[model samples]
Target: MISLRNVTLRRGTKVLLDAASVTVNPGEKVGLVGRNGAGKSSLFALLAGNLHEDGGEFLLPPSWRLAQVAQDMPETEDSATDFVIAGDSRLMAAEAEVKAAEAAGDGERMAYAYTALHDAGAHDAQARAQALILGLGFKTTELNHPVNSFSGGWRMRLQLARALMCPSDLLLLDEPTNHLDLDALVWLESWLKRYEGTMIVISHDREFLDAVTNVTLHIDVGRLTRYGGNYSTFEETRAQQLELQQAAYDKQQEKIAHLTSFITRFKAKATKAKQAQSRVKALERMEKLAPVLASAEFTFEFKEPANLPNPMLVLGDVDCGYAPAEDAAAGAMPTVIVRKATHTVSAGQRIGILGANGQGKSTLVKTIARTLAPLSGIVTEGKGLSIGYFAQQELDVLRPQDNPLEHMVRLAKEALPEGESGREQDLRTYLGAFNFSGDMVKQAVGTMSGGEKARLVLAMLVWQRPNLLLLDEPTNHLDLATREALSVALNEFEGTVMLVSHDRALLRAVCDEFWLVSRGSLAPFDGDLDDYQQFLLDEAKRVREAIKESQKEARAAAAPVLAPAARKSSSNLKALQRDLGKLEQQMLELQTQKNAMEARLSTLSDPQEIGELGLKMQTIDESLADIEDRWLAISEEIEALSS
Candidate 1:
């Protein structure tokens, strides 16, 4: 258990928490949420022991193990699996003892060290590390790749995996899903749900919080409030609390008004003078219910486009991906992720882009946004078509050196028509609408926080008054309130929207249909996000099973050398015979199912249906594992008997 008793914390002159107290029970999964810059991270810092409270007392079990994701980007050349395995401090310590015992040539010491190492799971250390890596959305082949080979986003994922690999009683995670794709986010949610340790997570993702958290802790106005349920329940409970507060405030105000009016009118009248004085006394004695001051909400909507272009975009056999490097040798072909993708973006259509990480969801959106050119085929734009594109990386579309006003002025110069008025005051007013008022408009984009930068980008996007909006992970840095607001805005927009996001709530609220990118092709998804989650789980299982099967093949290839060691095990021949017979029957049934599914997969034209059936075949493959292992054992026994 952890407790913060009337704790006060400050950073420089700003007070983050004032007399805030909250108790977190053991094994509780708490979602710490607040608006951007509302001390959620500060509270995390307090819990992590990086900062001390200026006043009051904070307590935690002193012996409890703690783990948190490191913020610094890793620069080491170590293999990814090895790096994650290093996070298991107990295993590392046990291994160190084993080596020290070996160097000292002490048999008793070596025996104790070996026992400790086994207790710490030293044998399956690599398997555990690799499992965490794969669950965080890395390819099986990349498990042993150099850590520094991955990009910054992927490296952050590795850092998260390392943290999760640590054996901890208390875990703290801050914005862990900011870089994850939908598939990876879903995987993480499932993993976290099964975690038995106490977890305090700071995430802007509503669905994730709802799924993983059993408690909610909110920070507002230097106060901490504890709620008994998930994010959705907290929202509902808080709304009702606010309503009751508002009603009390209103009743108090009415009573105060009546008291003041009576005193003013009757104080001069002799007969009512005593009554007025008594009324004044009563007013002074009464307790006041203060008015509810709601937190400032940030919201903005896309301006209606000047013209609606039906069939805003038409792609004919377009291959979406990257082109070869300029310094490449002659005849270098482009890297095409999605082959022959043909689709139309019509007016008022809402389409959600779906895929696993690296499956080209972002590539498809980039091609449509014209940031990346298509490898081949035609992209036709209808007359009066206008596009408002939100790149996944804010810096991709923003000049970090410039401020919000400069960004808007540049957009006015390039996007606004010659005859149209593009006054600075109007731009300032518009920026204010997105909550970038006063000195903030002059603040350099590079110095602003991620959520603030996202707001600035949205402000500029709205100014363009584009009919077609192509948004890529727009909610990655947005808080829950802002995400809901964006959902509403998108719903009200009269133009078309093509969104690529891992925010399930936003997707459910705004998207009308989906397009899935997989295996070098694009197809219309026939089911909902729930089905997509199942597909991702199946995909991950297949990756794990494939790794296992490859290991089995490697072992079989080396079996000849192990023949001598495997002999003389014929004592269990009768038991081995019975096991092999039962395993053979199970294998026969699984093989029949596999053959049927493969045949069905061949005839299926619908992509979603094919994917579902293919996943079934993978399940059959898993069920047949026992038969293979038992058959090998029986063969070894028979050979040993003959020898």
Candidate 2:
């Protein structure tokens, strides 16, 4: 358990926290929410002991271990697996001590070594490490790959896995879901749900927070407020509180106005001078209400060119994935990672692509954007169509040395004709619309944060004002407020949009159709993400029933042999058979739990709930599959022994 008491944190001229207090209890999952510049990361640093607070103290149990995943991963030359394995230094040290004792052949020391190893769970550490690696989206082949080979996004995933693997009493995560795809996000959600230790997550992903957290900690205007529910519930309660505050302030203001009017009307009247003077005194003593700041206005307008055809983009028999080697056999068919994919986007369609990580969602987006060439499919462009592509790697296109304004100018030149009208004005207006104004526009792109770069990329895309927009993980680094603003802007935009993102809430808000890209195929859900979630639940149930039946058949096939063994060695064989029966019953219980979860999933319409349900279903399916496999193997062994 950890507590912050009267903590005050200052960053240069800004006061991030003033007399802020928060408590994280054992097994408590807290979601930290604030504006981008409100110093959520700074607070995490203070808690992690990476930074000292200007005032007050953070109290923790003397033996409590804490780990934080920083936003910026330090540059390292080690391999990804090596970096993660380093997290178990304590366990490794214990192992070394045990080895030393073994070499000496001291019975007492050897006994101590065994105890130490057992206490540290060293035997199972490798298994846990492997699971963490897989959960974080690293392939087995890539585990030993050098860290330098990965991009920033992949490096962030490595850091996340490292943080998660560290044995700690409390974990502090700063935007841990920023770089994860849907599959990784789902895995993380499930892991956190079953995690026994405490966790404090700082994230802008609404669905992620809702899925993993039970409490919400909100930092607004140097004040901290705790809500005892998920993000959506907290948001609703906060809205109600704000409305009540505004209403009270309005009533106070009306009373004050009436008193002032009375004083002004009667100040000169001799008979009423005393009352007027008393009213003036009361007015002077009254504390003025703090003016409520207006929410930032986010307005986006797309200057539509000529109308395009009904189908904005079309792919026929598309094979979307990374291109193969150029010097390969000339007549060989390109291996289709995503095969027989044919889809059409209309001029007014708002479509979202949904699938697990490494399932070719990004590949499809890139192919549609024309950033990558399809292996063998015909990609047809609609008549008079102009596409605006916002790739996940858009930040790479920015010049490190160029300032934001300079970058905008370069992009404008590339997008505009030679003598376009009001190009500079358009850039300024677009930048302002995205909340970059004054000196922020002059900051160097290299010095900007990930969120800032993402905003700039979005601004550039809006300036182009294409009729069809292709956005891939556009809200990756955006804060909650920014995401809401984006949702509003996208809802207002008249042009068509095709987006690939793991933020289910954003998808539900902005997309009218769901494009399920999975297992090298594409299926369209004409409704919203809610409909897609129901479909997934139904599919999971069908898979579960099929697996259950397969397991039953295997058990039936081995039953006759077990019966003969039971007659020969009644006691021992009956015990073993009872054990197997118990295991089978447990598996059935797990399957029943899975079906219940599926039913609950079907009834939910909230994206956050759906995401959580999807994760639970996946975890249940994996466990059920493992149990069935184990049972089948045991049945085979029993049959072989009987023979």
Candidate 3:
């Protein structure tokens, strides 16, 4: 349990919380939300003991083990698996004790250390770490790679995996999904749903919040408010409260205005002098209500293109991938990622690109953006075609040392169409539309936050007046407000859009169709996001099955033929088989119950009831997963005995 009673938290001279109180019960998954700079992260810092409260009581279990992603870049040469395994400090300590005991030849101490290691599950620590890595979209081959070899975003994913691998009673995650793809995000949601610890996650992802959190803690204007249920419920409840508050404010203003008018008119008259004096007292004694102020809304639109082509871009039997580096001594062949991809993207089409990580979603987008030439086949462009591309890596297109004004000026000179002015003043005003104004326009792009850089990219894109937008993971670092603004703008835009993002909310709101870039091909997906989620699950299962089969074959190839006497007794094998069958039956029953609960969830109209059903289903699924693991272990024993 955690409690903050009338807590006042301040950083420098800015007071984030004044007399704010909140109580979080054990085992609750809380979504901490607020506008950027609203102290959500500050609260996390307080909980993590990195910051201290200015006043009042801040209570947290001193003995609680806390887990959080490291914000600093990981700089190490350790293998990824080893790095993740190090997260379990207890297990590492136990293993170290065992080694020390053995070195001292202390029999009793060695036994005690061995017991501790077993209790910490030291033997399975590597397997657990590997599982976390795989769920985060890492291939098996990458497990042995040095941690520092990964790019910054992949390093962040490694940090996330390491935090999740830790044994903690309290988990604090901030923007955990920023670097994750849809597949990894879905996997993470399922994992968090099964976590038994108290979790406080600060995220801008609405769908993720609704899926994993049971409570919402909103920080606003030096106040903290707790709401029951998920993000959607919180939003709905907050909307109602705001509406009532606005009505009350309006009514109170009218009353105050009428009393003021009455006092002004009758103060000089002897007949109404006493009443006027009373009215003035009433006005002085009345408590004023503050008006409900809505958060600022961000809105921007793409300028209409000079010409809208029927087929803005075409990839005809193309092979999209990275070309060999010019400096490569070998001058090797181009590494193809998406092959035989023939597709036509026309104006006014909204397409969401879907794929697992490393499956060429970005490659396809880059090919269309002309960042990479097709390895094979021709890329045909229509007459008067224009493209507005937003790269996932903002630094890829942005000149770090250049200010927003300079970037805009450069874009105007390089990408602006004929008849468009390339003047510095015009570009500066254009940057202001994206919220860069005053001295901010002169600030270096390298010094800006990711969200600001993303906005700058969008502003540059809009400045070009492209009829087609190719955005890859555009919402990665954006806040909820900025993401909403981008979604609304995309929804209202008349130009064609091709977006590759893990943000399902934005995808659902803006995309009318989806294209899958999987297995080295591009094709239209008939169904929507829900269908894609199911597809990812099925694909994961298939991959697991294939790995199992490959392992089985490898074991067969490695094993030497055994004598008949080497086999285990038939009765023992039969007993193990019987246990496996019972476990399988239990899992099947639980799965059926879970599926029924899911079906009911869809039809239930009440939010509370739906949340209850979802939790119930999650419990059943967890139990089924346990049973499935048991079944697998027993079956493996049975197979070993029979062999």
Candidate 4:
């Protein structure tokens, strides 16, 4: 359990938390949420013991093991797997004892050390570490690669994996999904559901909070409030509270007006002078109620496209990827990701691109945007085709040293007709619509936050009024309000849209269809998100089974010196097959239930009801995962024996 009673925390002159109190019970999963710069990170720092409260008591079990993602990027030569494994301090200690005992040649000591190692699960630690790394989107082949070989984003993912690897009684994760793709986010959600400990996560993703957290802890206006249930519940409850507060304020204002009016009208009359004085005294004694101050909300709409082009783009026998450098001294071939993709993107189509990381989703998007040329095919565009591309890496399109006004000016100069470039004042007004005003309009892009940069890009896109929008992870850096605004704008826009996003809310709101990019093929997926999830699960199973088969064949090829009993017996094979069949049947039932629950969840509006359904769905997912693990273990045993 953790307790913060009347906690007053400050950094220099700013008060992050003032007289804020919250008690988080053991085993409770809490979602810490607030607007950006509302002291969310400061509270996390306080919990991590990097800061101390200026007043009141902050207490937790002294012996509890706490795990948190490291903020610093590690530069080390250790393999990724080794770095993750090192997070388990207890396991490492146990292994060290085992090695020490063996060196000393003490039989009794060695037996005790081996028991400790087994109890620590040191024997399968590598396998568990590998699973964490894989779930975080690292390739299996990269598991043994040096940690420093990864890019900055991948290194941050490594830090997340290491934090998850540590065995903890309390875990704190801040913006863990910021660096993850849709597939990795899904995997992390499932993994967190299986964590049987107290967890506090700070994230801006509403759907993710609803999925993984049961309690909500909000920091606002230098105070803390705890709400039962998930983020949706908290939101509903807060809205109701605000409504009541507003009503009370209005009632108080009415009384004040009546009293003041009576005093003004009757004060001069001799008979009523005494009553007016009494009224004045009463008014002075009344407690004042402050009006509710709502957070600022902004909305902007995209301008209508100048022309609507039917069959906006056609990809015939398209191979999308990078072309080899013509100046290469050695033999080099073009790296193709999507092979011979033949498709037509029609006008007014709202298509969502779906794929795992490293798949061809981005490659195909780049090809359509004409940022990357097709390797060996024709990419024909309509006569009036115009494109607005929002790249995943924002800096790729934005100049870090340029201000918002400057970027908008550059965009107008390049995109407008020969003599129709908009005036500088109009461009400034347009930038103002995206919340860049006064000095902010002149602020350099390098000094702005991610959300600000995203807004600037969107401002530029909307100003050009392109007929087609190719957005890749547009919601990655957007806050909830901005994401909602973007969804509304996309829904209202008449342009064709091809979106690649991990934000489920935005996807559900804007996308009308989905295209799957996998295994070097691009094709339409005739199903919803639920079906896609099931497909991913089934594909994973098939891949694992294929790997097992390959291993079995390899063992058989080397079986000349093996004993005959090592081979599978008829009875053993029959029993294993029976067990597998039973597990599959159970899994099918769970999958059906899961899909049904998901469908119901989509139609649900009540926060409490949605929370309940989410929990049920999470339970079903955990059960399904457990059954899959069992099936894999049993199949592996059968394969080893049969080989």
Top-scoring candidate (TM-score): 1
Model 3 global lDDT (CA atoms, 0 to 1): 0.81
Error of 1 at 187 (Å): 1.2
Error of 4 at 464 (Å): 1.9
Candidate 1 per-residue lDDT over residues 441-545, each given as its tens digit: 899998988878888888878888889999999988788777766765675566788999999988876777899999889999999999988988898888778
Q: Give residue 263's error in model 1 in angstroms.
A: 50
Clash pairs (backbone) in predicted model 2:
none
- Clashes in predicted model 4: 0
**For residues 367-422, what per-residue lDDT tens digits would candidate 2 score against the true structure?**
88888888877999888787889888888888878877777788777766887644
A best-first ranking of the candidates according to their TM-score comes to: 1, 3, 4, 2
Give one clash count per candidate, in the order shown.
0, 0, 0, 0
Tell me the tens digit of each residue's lDDT in model 4 across 1-643.
Answer: 8999999999889898999999999999999987666798899988888989999999989988899999899999999999999988789888899789768765545555655776787757999998899888887689999999999889999999999989999999988988888888888999999999999998878789999999999888899999999987887676557646666456546656766887899789875554465456545432221121123245676787888787898999999999888897587888999999999988778899999888889999999998899999999999899899998886556888989888988888787788777798998888887889899989999998887888888988888789999999888777655665576567656678899988876776677789999999999999988787777667666756876778666555443223132234324787777777888899999999988986886676665566566556657867886777666666666776688
Global CA lDDT computed for model 1:
0.81
Candidate 1 residue spans exceeding 4 A from truth: 104-108, 244-296, 417-421, 564-643
Better of 1 and 4 by TM-score: 1
**Residue 82 error, candidate 1, Å:** 0.8
State the lDDT of candidate 3 residue by residue for 210-262, as single tens digits: 99999999999999999999987887676557646666456446656756886
Give the TM-score of each candidate: 0.81, 0.74, 0.80, 0.77
